[model samples]
Target: MCGGDFMSKNPEEAMDFLSYVADVSRGWDEPTKGEVGKMKSQLNAYNAKAGM
Candidate 1:
């Protein structure tokens, strides 16, 4: 939730934040799969917001 406001206000920042989440999640273990799924949902939200 660190950049919730920034992401909502700035599409570019949202994309960057989501990309970072995706990159970081790539190094996570299986136990963190659920967290990664959450990130995916966030990414989808960002995409929808930015009309990507």
Candidate 2:
């Protein structure tokens, strides 16, 4: 909780938003492995923090 309640305090919402971004990004262009990995890392980190 760095600096308390960052962008999204809701875990489910954050995950949903990330999933949506991934889907939308796919339509825009093919996301590289690094880009996908970054998103995954973010979700995993958030999930861990939220104890999901």
Candidate 3:
């Protein structure tokens, strides 16, 4: 934690990062159904954060 990189300070930024992760994970085949479930959970979480 020497460069303010490990800890997250912005909710929007974190969501953006998680969105990118979810997008890339969409192309993978590992974990099959698990990945989809996790992705959906993340999406719901983001939406709830935005109060949508």
Best by lDDT: 1
Residue pairs with clashing backbones, model 3: none
Weakest 10 consecutive residues, lDDT, candidate 3? Answer: 1-10
Q: What is the per-residue lDDT of model 3 for residues 1-52, given as tens digits with 9 covering 90 to 100?
A: 1245525547777677768778888877566688889999999999999999
> What tens-digit string does per-residue lDDT give for candidate 1 at 9-48?
5787778878888888887755477888999999999999
Write down the TM-score of every candidate. Answer: 0.42, 0.42, 0.42
- Model 2 residue 26 CA deviation (Å) reads 8.6
> What's the lDDT for residue 39 in model 1?
92
Ranking by lDDT: 1, 2, 3
Candidate 3 or 1, higher lDDT: 1
Using TM-score as the measure, the top candidate is: 2
Q: Roughly what TM-score does model 1 have, to 2 decimal places?
A: 0.42
